[model samples]
Target: MSKHLPLRDAVLSWLEYAGSLSPKSHSIVMLMLQPHWEDVVMAVAAVAPRDEHPDLYAKVKGDWMLDHRTLLVESGLAEAAQLIAQGVSVPVSDVADSFVTFCTGQARVPERWLLLNATFPQRTRIALGRHTLQTFTADELRQTVPAPALNGLHPWSLDLDLIAGAPFLHVPDPSRTVTRRPTWFDITGPRAEAQHWQALLPLMLWDNELLRVDSVFTVQHGRRFDLHPPAVPTTIRVYPGSQGREEEVEVRDTGEFHVRPIHLSALTAFCTAITKKIDAITAGLTHTRRVPKLRARRLERAGRHVVAAYQRTYDDYGIWEVEADELYLDYVIALEALLISPDDGKDEGIASRIRSRAAALFLTPTERERTEALVRRAYDARSRYVHGDKIKEQSEHEKLEELRALRLLTLQIILRWLVLTPADTGDLAPLLDAAAQGTGREQHIDRPLHAFFATTSPRSRPADIVLT
Candidate 1:
């Protein structure tokens, strides 16, 4: 068996590296460097800590300094020593081995390192961007690093795959009304086979997944990228009948789902796609700074005061149990839908009043045009009673035609808002022109718009085909 280095030396060198990376805001970045008893001895010798070394120092008490490297970095002296005595200390000499043992073992060391490595770059970005107006979000975290081994690091040591596969969950703070720290998780296997699970726990508790960036606001063809894990069957199916006969189908799928592993490169690509979309959406609008009359002056004023806080609630705390809480958002969507499809047979009181107010506040210019046209048609329908002129009967046919026309046009306008940004004016102009022409391009023009409303529709294909 190879002799182990002294624990002091190993701690010193590891501490030096970690100390170098610490920011002013934080204390020592104590990465618990673990090594076997024999290797620990060699490392301690290499580090050579000197401070009145006792003859019986073999059982040195709590965390001891190995100052050969100007700092100390080692596993918890008390716990690690106990672990080594138990013969479960992973026997390895390299950093990679240390990392793997940290991950696979029940010890907390692996989870800490995984978090440190993954978040170090993000913290660096935040520190740099702090001086600028730019902000960082999980969606904006798409840095392309060179292959790790090429940097002369451990081969097969660092699990960058775990970092890439992780899903970010951000929950909004209900009272503070801003996003809290995002939680990241990697559902890579049945039971989260590594310390990576601890790294993801915070975000999951906050229900971060439900606070997803609106796919609507992302790159036009992004959802089409479809970089999802394959469908793990919750139930399996079996055919019992002979070939060409009336077959009976039996389903037996009953396992926790797992998908083919997504590569780190693919994760990079996905983030890049979202970044591009955010870039497009905010591009021209930011430059032009043309705050449209999407809302009334008073409402706009109120929105300015409240929207930040409103957005914060979703951004920080998020809608917990989204399927259950999403109905809270339906008020806004239903209002928009009702603008196009008014309940003519039903009597309106407070509901219509509130809907009309929302329409004024939320409807864009094109949307307002379509909505006003619908209102005019409804007045003529007589099926809907409204204060109108005597010519309502004569305009009945025109009103009905206008109803469908405005509904379709309204849908397209909203879809455009969803799919393209004013910054993408160059790419989107042609599409808008095609839509405006309303000729043979109706289906094509309507595709993106229809797709948004038809997300649950089987006829729905990918967003890329409809948008691009």
Candidate 2:
């Protein structure tokens, strides 16, 4: 066979390039490969060292070639390509050529012979096609892994534990913050500015639905790329309506240009933190604070009903272990805070402000009445129980039960309000779901959500805008 000059030059160039990309020596050669070429390079690299670059044995060990290939094939890129080709107007020749070139020298492998066998001029011709590779969005990335995309591309998968309760994108700038931006500098950070154009062009070319999967593909070339994706943990300010309705008032652009892989634990942690806070806030609103006395037995029985309702709601949202009594105490504290919030001007009274804001945000006539009636009953029952008053008949227990039901109803209402407020900007609903398996929502929710929040910015004093 004719000597593989292109393959040789490409391999040497790639090794030098890969070394430059990392902060440490002995970096993965395939790291330089772009999403379109990642697998092809990995596969070539896996086999190449066995013969081509025996001198580089200390740098790589490759018994795991099959394992890596399985990862790519499992990504479903091959299948996705088949589907797209049916309707794609692009000719197949362009794709075949891209694939051949990618599989050859650009594969980022250290092995020589493996590289030679993999790169074929004929194969390159066969792989050529006009169709561009498939891509995905950050919102569509999920915890559970779905099947891979066609042509060996796969949506990014992460360990769930990495993201559980961990914050997404670290706020303000989702892209790595390189430096502070001056007002004169229209573009903020380096990556942020680059991604605006990077994400924009691909986004315009693809349908919104396609972006949600957020998969990565690699040609044999050493270039990595993000599929069309929006910034993660998209925060939106919403206006909560009574009856658990949230109307999108504004959405904030996270300024995320590329899809960065995150740990599953981070995703979970974020969910847990927000949910726990919600649970804490809701539980606080449910119970009253009167100490038990001579009528303790009667009060305890009423408390059980309240506890059961609280637990039930928690269970629906995958929360347990929050004891009935603790939840009851929280409910009482929240109720008192809500009642006194309008007058609680104390700087440290954050709970009061939250309550006051909630009251102002959503207390339609019907909802207002419901809240008042429940608070009234809880207050009276608490007073009677604490004062050592005589226990009444069955009617009192019935009244307590009514209060429990109303309390649960109110908690749900409050959560809706809490999630919509700009103060709750970290509540990342759409981005969190992106980590979930399966196809995700069609359009990006971040912009609309941010827009929702921006609407209220005008109401704030100009001095408080926090503009940089």
> By TM-score, who's the top model here?
1
Error of 1 at 410 (Å): 14
> Compared to the true structure, candidate 1 yields what TM-score?
0.29
lDDT (0 to 1) per candidate:
0.28, 0.30
1-468, model 1: which lDDT tens digit per residue?
122323434433443343333233123223334323345444544433344332112433565543321121222232222223334432224333332222122311111111210121222221111011112333332211111111113232223332333322222112221111122233332221122221121111111121111110001010011111121112234455677565544322222111123322332333333334333443434344332222122122222222222222332223233221222232233233322222233455434443343233222455545454454443334222323333344343453344334323332322233344233223332334344444424453445445533432211132223332
lDDT of 2 by residue, 215-266 (tens): 1111111212222223122346779877999887433222222222332233
Clashes of each: 28, 98
Give the Cα error of residue 465 in candidate 1, in Å: 8.0
Q: The CA-based lDDT of model 2 is what?
A: 0.30
